[model samples]
Target: MVDRVAARAHETIDRVAAKAGPAVEKLRESASTYREQLHAKADRLGALEEQWIDSARSYVREHPFTSLAVAAVAGMVIAKIFSSSHHR
Candidate 1:
């Protein structure tokens, strides 16, 4: 009778473990997918940052004063927008 009870207890433990194994596997799979996605996005952002740097260098080389003027105007516009928004 003691052996039978021990066998049933082990069977119940095995069943619970079997159910938990799939849930743990699913969590690991989702974490892997999310990690991969984040890495891909970081790579894309790196490429975009390099492109923007190249563009800015080229723009500065071509037109220093024009770039400054445009930047100032845009900054003023943005500030004005933000100031107006805050007032509301």
Candidate 2:
């Protein structure tokens, strides 16, 4: 009787493991696919960022005075925000 019970327990464990194996494999494949997609998106975003930086450089060079005025206004706004936060 004990031997039969042990055999039955072993069979149950094996069945459970078999069922779990395919589920685990599917999960691994899904994770790998997601990782690849994220890498592709990051590469595209990096290229876009480089393009924008180059465009900005050209614009700044062509209109230095305008860029300076914009920078000054932005700096003042940032300073005002920080100063107000500090007072609070």
Candidate 3:
């Protein structure tokens, strides 16, 4: 009886280990896929940043005074909005 019970327990452990092995492998596969997706997104973001930098530099060179005036006005508006909201 003791030998039978031990064998049964070992069998149960083996069964659980077998199930867990596949689950772990699937999780690893999913992580690898997510890493690939993130790399693709990072590449796209890099291209977008380069595009924006080139556009911004060109705009600054073309309209330095206009850009500075617009920036100053926008900053003043934002500061006023925040300052008023915080006071309230």
Candidate 4:
């Protein structure tokens, strides 16, 4: 009787595993697809960032004095914001 019960338990486990196999495979394929999509998006974003950096560099080269003035004003504004936040 004990042997029969053990055999039956093993059969049940095997059946459950067999039923689950396809679902697990589907989930794995979906995860792989999502990973590929995420990687593609990251690559595109990296390229866009590089493009923006190059554009900014070109702008600064064309207008060095304007860029310097903008940088000074931006720095002062940022410093003021931080100083006020610290006081609060």
TM-score of each: 0.67, 0.92, 0.84, 0.91
Worst 10 residues of 1 by lDDT: 59-68
lDDT of 1 by residue, 1-88 (tens): 9999999999999999999999999999999999999999999999999999999999998999999999999999999999999999
- 23, model 4: CA deviation in Å? 1.3
Write candidate 2's Cα lDDT for 1-88 as tens digits.
9999999999999999999999999999999999999999999999999999999999999999999999999999999999999999
The TM-score between candidate 4 and the true structure equals: 0.91
The residue pairs that clash in candidate 4, if any, are: none
Q: What is the C-alpha RMSD of each candidate to the true structure, in Å?
A: 3.2, 1.1, 1.6, 1.1
The candidate, 2 or 3, that scores higher on lDDT is 2
Q: Tell me how many clashing residue pairs each candidate has.
A: 0, 0, 0, 0
Which residue runs does candidate 3 get wrong by more than 4 Å?
none
> What Cα-based lDDT does every candidate model obtain?
0.99, 1.00, 0.99, 0.99
Encode model 4's per-residue lDDT on 1-88: one tens digit a residue: 9999999999999999998999999999999999999999999999999999999999999999999999999999999999999998
Model 4 spans > 4 angstroms off = none
Model 4 residue 20 lDDT?
Answer: 99
lDDT of 3 at 12: 100
**Residue 31's C-alpha lDDT in candidate 2?**
100
Count of clashes in candidate 3:
0
